[model samples]
Target: MAGEVPAAAAAASATLLALELAWSPSTLTDADIEVLVVQGLLLEKAISGWRSYFGEASPSEDWTATVVFRSFYEKGFGLPSGAFFWGLLHYYGLEATHLKPNSITQIATFIHLCKGFLGIAPHFNLWRALYHLRAYPSKGTPDVVGGAAFSLHRGGKYPEAIFKDSNKRWAEEWFVVANPTPGLLPRTGLPPVVNARWEEKPTEEEMVEVQVLLAELQKHKAEKLTGATVALSFAKWLTQPI
Candidate 1:
């Protein structure tokens, strides 16, 4: 009977932890939100252009572009830095995969961040931190969520289980999107687009819409993005070098 009681206690503890992850509000700061919005906008532009240029061809054929885009997504959002979402997860001592409902919601949050800028649907800021942690390359660090494993180490969302089992080669779809171009010019002057965006400021009616969205996101649970769109945006963002 005593053993049974201990087992029950352990089960209860596990359940409680799960509940905490599910119910906890992300500890995001104003700065973090600003960065996410900026990163999302940039990615939207990059990915859109990549898709348009590449057409139906696979992105694996253009590796330099892929790495550059990943760098923009990870580094641009301060994913590897101490002040971003990873810091929040560090505060809680949880890994990206261990997030509330798992990694899907985290992935959804990245998508939403971009869409949110447009004031579109599913603007929930769910998994704001976890998404960054999962997407950023860990550089073989054991303390960080990703280590030496290719699936976990590379920038961008960790490979989905379906991706692994589909026999379509997730690695090719993800890591080796295309051949690397040594002569390609790096995209550094991106219009300071995010700063210019903030300068516009929100309207009074827009503020009310934002408030309503926030209220909904507070209670919302977590929530792909197509390859054509991603490739087009990325290609255009890099090739034009503007």
Candidate 2:
């Protein structure tokens, strides 16, 4: 590994997991399946933490890591990646990772977090906060909390509207033009992907509160999701919804 992760960090992570595993940590929940599920989530986090601590090897390291994490959280431990996407969703909402809503799992998550948070409405003024946050803002965050980097588009000035979710593309064609209120916009035109394979198209009510937040990127005009900064943008997007 070029970056060379220190042995100390690895050892510490291993010990933490070992301690949790040894004590039958699942005792709080009597159900074996529940215990197993939580244990699996913890294990997934430990492994990812270890991998991140190491060097950047995979060209698409972050993308691959995303798949690994999602698989463990969504499939393995039965968790979804966005219990709380970005800054909009509340921390308490993380507990409801199990509540899988209709099709837009991430969107439902955003709504839940917004409603649950119940205060500290960030003044919705990200620009000012960034200025005060420090003498300078990070590259992605820039001078605003909900800037382009936090956008799903990740990069690009005019918003290519391609690199985002296909279904979202259909949503966006209409979304950008309409007035949104942290909720889903009604459907128009054909849905992105539907048929026997997808089973059905997501209904308007089904995705009513699912918000669509896309912004322009700083560095590149045409959005691209194949780089480190893109992944960092995604992290920023996930941690703090715009």
Candidate 3:
């Protein structure tokens, strides 16, 4: 009887903890939102010419440019690859402020930021986060007391299950080498490691691309960009080429 009582108490405690976590508000701050907005805008500008050069109307589907364009589109904005995403964060000096790749809660928060602040389409990473969290949209009961329009029920077990899986490949996908060259590494099937560093430094070409983006932003400072703010001046100064 004593064992049964202790077991029941433990289960109740766990349930309370889960509920507490579920109802907790997001941890992102104003500065985090500003950083995300700037990063999204820069990435959008970096790929602006791709559509005209290698989009659906391109002469040949078999060409590498066409393939690259389609791949980036499929991946969504600011996520051509995990390495690219990491590089952009690093280039913007957001390495310390950005969410950790291995954290399910942080990833979910980032997705929410992208959707709510950037007003952009969700990518595979969002889908993956949802799947791993076993989350599903909930439509509230109509005309009932305390009813709401909609909500999401994020599953409890899957978040922990991801860490326990013998194959840690999924977690590995969230990280990359500090200085990665695009197309140099395969996207998946990396050997799992106990500790992974999430920060990444941009390549020379990426640095130049970012410099061009800042220059363009400077030229068009008078024009308003969606989701952009004066915070960008700080980012430009931080990323100025040495």
* Per-candidate local distance difference test: 0.31, 0.25, 0.29
**Ten contiguous residues with the weakest lDDT in model 3:** 142-151
lDDT of 1 by residue, 177-239 (tens): 121222222222111111122113345665565555544433332223332233344344432
- In TM-score terms, which candidate is top? 1
For model 2, what is the alpha-carbon lDDT of residue 231?
28
lDDT per residue (tens digit) for residues 109-185 in model 2 = 22332333322222222211111111113333222111112223223222232223323111111001111133222
- Name the runs in model 3 displaced over 4 angstroms: 1-21, 24-201, 222-242
Q: 1-242 in candidate 3: lDDT tens per residue?
A: 87999999999898655533321122323343334336542233234222222112212222222112121121132333354344433332222111222232233333433344434433332323223221112222111111111112264111121211232222112211122234222221111211112212344655554454334434444354321232232234332110
> Candidate 1 at residue 208, lDDT?
66
Models 1 onward score TM values of 0.22, 0.18, 0.20
Please count the clashing residue pairs in each candidate, in the order shown: 26, 10, 0
In terms of lDDT, the poorest run of 10 residues in model 1 is 189-198
**Model 2 spans > 4 angstroms off:** 1-50, 57-64, 67-79, 83-113, 117-147, 150-242
Clashing pairs in 2: 73-79, 86-238, 86-239, 86-240, 87-239, 87-240, 87-241, 156-217, 156-221, 184-208
